[model samples]
Target: MPFFKKKEPKKTKEQLEKEEEDKKAEEEKKILENEKQIEVAYRFLMQPEVQKFSDINKRVFLRKRGLTTDQIDQAFKRRDEKKESAQTGTEQQQITQQEQKASEENKSVLVYSETLEQKLATALKNGFLSIQKSNTTELSPKIFEVSNLKTLVASQNMLKEIPDAIGNLVNLRVVQLAECGLTNDVISDKLFSLPNLVELNLSKNKLTSIHLIVNLPELQRLDISYNNIVELPEDIEKCQKLQLMNIQNNYINFFPHNFTKLVNLKRILISGNQFEKEAEDALKSTGVEGLFKFLSQ
Candidate 1:
C-alpha cells in the first residue's frame, strides 16, 4: 500500500452555513457589548467628580480599569456628539419660544386694543383671562359676565377678596390667585363651588384654613403653600380627583381623619410644617403614600 493518509470528510453546505451564521451572531454580540462598554465609560467619565480629572489622568484612570485607548476615544467622541445635539435642541427650542412669544405679543396688540376691562372681557370670550401685576386692586364685575370663562389668573395683585361673582363662571376650570394678599375672611365661599374647577392656586397668601363646604368633583391640583393654614378640612378628602396638594410652610400638625380616603392623591408637600417627629420621619423617608399609611394606622 502507498503511504497516503485518508482525506477527512468535507463539511456539508448546511453545516458551513450554520457555522457562518453562528460566527456572525457572535461578532454582533461582541459589537453590542463593546458599545455598552463605551456608554458606561462615557457616563463614568462625565460624572461631576471625574470631570475634574485632567485629560491625561482620565485616560490613565480608564486604562487602569481595563478600557482600551480606542474605547476611551469613542466615549469622548460620543460625549461631544451628545453635547452638540443638546445645544442644538436647546437653541431650536429657544427660537421657537421666542417666535411664539412675538406672535402672542402681536396678537395682544391687535386684538386687545381697548380699556383694561374691555381687554379682559375679550380674553374671557376667548376662555382665558389674566390680570397680572397691573396694579389691579379688585376684579371688575364686568369680567364675570363671560359665563364660559375657563381660566382665570389674577396673580401679583393687591386684591383683598374674591367676589361671589366668580361663581357665575360656571365653566371655569382653572383659577390662580397667587400673591394676591388674600385673607381667609376675604375668600368667598362660592370660590369653591365651581362645578368644573380643576386647579386652584392660592399660594403666598394669609389664608388660615381651607374650608371645603362643597365637594369639588373635578379638582385636581391645590396649591396653598406659603400661607398661614392651621389645619386641613376633613372634607378635603371629598375631592376624589385630587392629585397634588401643596400645603408646605403651614402649621398643620396632623392629617384629617378621612385623609386616607384620597386614593387618587399622588403627591402632597407637607414640609415646613409642625408634624410630629415620627410622622415627619415617615414622610421624609417614604413620601406621601407612606405618610398616609402611617397616619391611617
Candidate 2:
C-alpha cells in the first residue's frame, strides 16, 4: 500500500478579493476616525481661552494629547479651505434664492390677494410660520395677516428684514427669528409694535443694533446671541417683565452701565464677549445673581 498525504484546498480569487476589500474598508474607517479627532483638536485649539496660552505651551499641550504640529497645521488649512468653499457656495445659493423669491413674490401677488385672514391661513398651511430646515424646497415670501397668530417661528430664512406688515399681528405672543440673516438697519420698527409680544428670539443674525425692542413691556424671554451688536440698546431696562436674556457671543466690551436696573431678570448670559477682568470675574462667580450684584457695585 502506498502512503498518500491529504492535500490542502487553496482559496479562490474571489475569496482573496473579498478579504482585501474588508481590510481596505476597515482602514478607511480608521482614517475617518483620525480625521474627526483632528477636527475636534482644531476647534479646541481655536478657542479664545486656549489661544491665550503661549505657542510653546500649546505645542506641549497638544503633544501630551498625542497630536502632532503637522496635524494641527493641516487641520487649520483644511478648515480654511472648507470655509472658502462654503462661503462661495452660500453666495451662489443666495443669488439663486433671491431670483426665485422674486419670481414667487409675483405669484404671491395672486396667492396673497385674498382677504388678510385667508392669506394668513394659506401661508400658515404652506410653511410660512415656522423655522424650516434648509432641506425644505423653495422658500416663498411668508407674509400673512392673522390677528390670532400666537406663535411664529421664522428662523433660518434669508430675510434681510422683518416685513412691516408683521406689526398687524397684535396677538402674537412668541416670535422666533433666529438665523434669519437680518442686517442692523434692515428690521422695520413696526415689528416692535406688537402689543402682546412676549418671547422674541433673534439669535445668530447680523444685527448691529437692538434699540427697537427696548420697550416691549410684556417680553419674558429675549435671545440676541451671535450678532454684531457693539452695545446694548438704550432703555433696555424698560422691559420690566423680562425674565431671561441671552446676549452672548457679540462684540460688547462691557455690560450696560445700569445693568442692575434689570432687577426682574432671572437669567442672563454674557459670555464670549470682550469683558473687562472685573466683569469677567463677576460673571465667573456663583451665578447670574452674583453678576448682577457685582454690576450693582
Candidate 3:
C-alpha cells in the first residue's frame, strides 16, 4: 500500500489534449504515405521497366494496390485516345465500332496504335526528352538524339506533323510511318529529301498526291500503298538510283508515260492498283531477291 502511493501522478487535461492532437497528426501522415504509394504503383504500370509483366498480373498488382479494374483500364487508354484523335486527320479509327461512319470492311483499313506512348518513352530514354507525362498530342519539337538511329518505327501512331526538327536525323536509313494518319505530306517530302534515307515505308496513309523517287541519290526502296494517291509524277524518271517501288492497293489510274527513262529502275510493284496498260517495259534492274519481296507478292 505504501509503494502504490509513491507512484507517479496522472497527466493533466492540457497535456492529454496535446497528446491527442499528436496522434491525429500521425494518422494523417500515414494516410498521405498510402496515397504516395498508390501513385508509385500507377507510375510503374506506365513505365517501360515494368512492361514485361503479363496483362493479368498487371491488373492483379494494380487491384491489390487499391486501383479498380475500371481505373486501370482508363489509365492504359489515355495514350491510345491521343493517337486515334490525331489519326482523325484523314483515316482516323474510332475507339469503338459505334463511332465509325464507314462500314466494317472499310474500317479494317484503320490501324490501332496501342504503343505510341511506350515508343515515345523509349525515344525519351534514347535522348528525345524527359517526358514523364504530357499532352499526348502535339509532339514536342525538342531535339532528339538520333546518332545512327537507322529505323524509326512509329507506325500506327497518331502522328500528324513531323517537325522540321526531323532534318536533324541525317543518318536515318529506314522510316516506317504506316497507318499513323500522317497528313502533312510535307513531312514525307522532307523525309524523301534526307540524304541518307534508303528505305521508306509510308503505306496505308491518307496522301492525295506525291512527288516520287525522282532524285533521291541514295534511295533504293519505296512503299506507298493504301492512300488517296492518284498517280505518280513523271519526275520519277529522274531518280536513277531507285531500285524498287511498291504502289499497292491505291487509286492510281494512269502509268507515267515517261517511266522508260529510269534505266536504273528495278523491280516495280504495281499490284493492288488498277493498271490500264501493263507496261511491257517493266523495271528490270531491281535485285529481285534483295529490295522488294513484298511488292512482288
Candidate 4:
C-alpha cells in the first residue's frame, strides 16, 4: 500500500486580507507613537525651566528620558520651525536690538566664565590670551572686540577653521595655532596682512599651502613645520625682516630662487623634506646657510 502525503491548509482570501490590515495597523501605531514621542520631547525642551539649559545639555536630557538621537533632533527641528514661523518683523527687530545691546555689554565685561568669551575678555584686558587643549572648535565673534590683543596662542585645540574676524586684531604680534587641526582653505588672507605680526607658528597642521606673506613688515620668525606643503609662496621674500624659519617635515622639493632675497634670515630648519641630492648634501654638510648659498648660486 502507498502512503498518502499530507498537505498544509491554505488561508482563505479574507484571512490573508486581515493579516495585511493588521500589518498596516501596526505601522500606523508605530508612526503615532513616534509622533507622540517627538511632541513630548519638544514640549520638554521648550519648558521655561528647560529653556535655560544649553543645547548640548538639552540633548542629554532628552537622551536620559529614553529618546534616541534622531527623535531628539526631530523635536529640535520642529521647535526651530515653529520659532521661525511665529517670528514677526517686530520680533526680528527686537532680537537684532537685543544682540546689539549684548555686543555692547560684552565689551565692558572684565571677567567672564571659562568660555571662549572669557578668553576674548581676558585678551581685551591683558592683550594676551592662551587656550590650549580646550576642545575649541570655533572662535567666538567676540574675538573681534579684543582689538588690543597682541598675542594669541590657541594650540592643541580642535579648531579646524579660523574665522576671518581674527584679522581685525591688527595689534597681534604673536600667533601660535600649532596642532589646531587647520587646513589650507581655512587660513584667512587677512592674517598675512597683519602689519604688526612678528612671530607666527602654524606647525603640526594639515596645510598644503599658505597665503602669500605680504604687508607683514614687522614679521620676524615663521614656523610651518610638519605639514603637507608642496611649495612656498614666491612672495615670501616680501618678509624682509624675517629672521628665523622652520619648514621641516613637509613635501617641498625646492625653495624658490627669490628665497635668497631674505637677507635677514639667520636660522632655518629644513630636515625631513623632499630635496634634491645636491641641496640635501649641502644642508647636511654646511647647514641652512650653505643650502641657501648653493640654491642662490
Query: Candidate 4's residue-wise lDDT over 1-297, tens digit each?
Result: 989888779999999999999999999999999999999998876765344335654564466568877787788888878777542112334434544564586632212222454355456668988866665567656666678999988889778578788889999999999998888788788788887999999999999986466568898999999999998887778888999989999999888878888889888888889888898788778876888879977
Worst 10 residues of 4 by lDDT: 107-116
lDDT by residue (1-297, candidate 1, tens digit) is 679898999999999999999999999999999898898889975765344334544554465467766787788778768667432112334434544664576534212222354445456448888877666667877678767789988889879689999889989999999999999788888888999999999999998878762357899999999999898887777888989999999888888888889889888888899988888787778887788878978
TM-score for each of the candidates? 0.59, 0.55, 0.49, 0.60
lDDT of 2 at 72: 56
lDDT of candidate 2 over 1-297, digit per residue (tens): 999998878989999999999999999998888888788777765665343334433434454467755665555556457556431112334434544674576643322222222334543445335544332222334343444567777677667567677777777888888887878677778778778888999999998888878767888899999999898865777887889989999999867666678878888888888877677777678567788777777
- The CA lDDT at 82 in model 1 is 69
Report clashes for each candidate as comma-separated counts. 0, 0, 1, 0
lDDT of model 1, residue 118: 42
Say which prediction, candidate 1 or candidate 3, comes out ahead on TM-score. Answer: 1
Candidate 2: pairs in clash: none
Q: Can you list the residue pairs that collide in candidate 4?
A: none
Q: Which ten residues in a row have the lowest lDDT in candidate 2?
A: 109-118
Q: For residues 248-273, what per-residue lDDT tens digits would candidate 3 score against the true structure?
A: 88888666666556566657676666
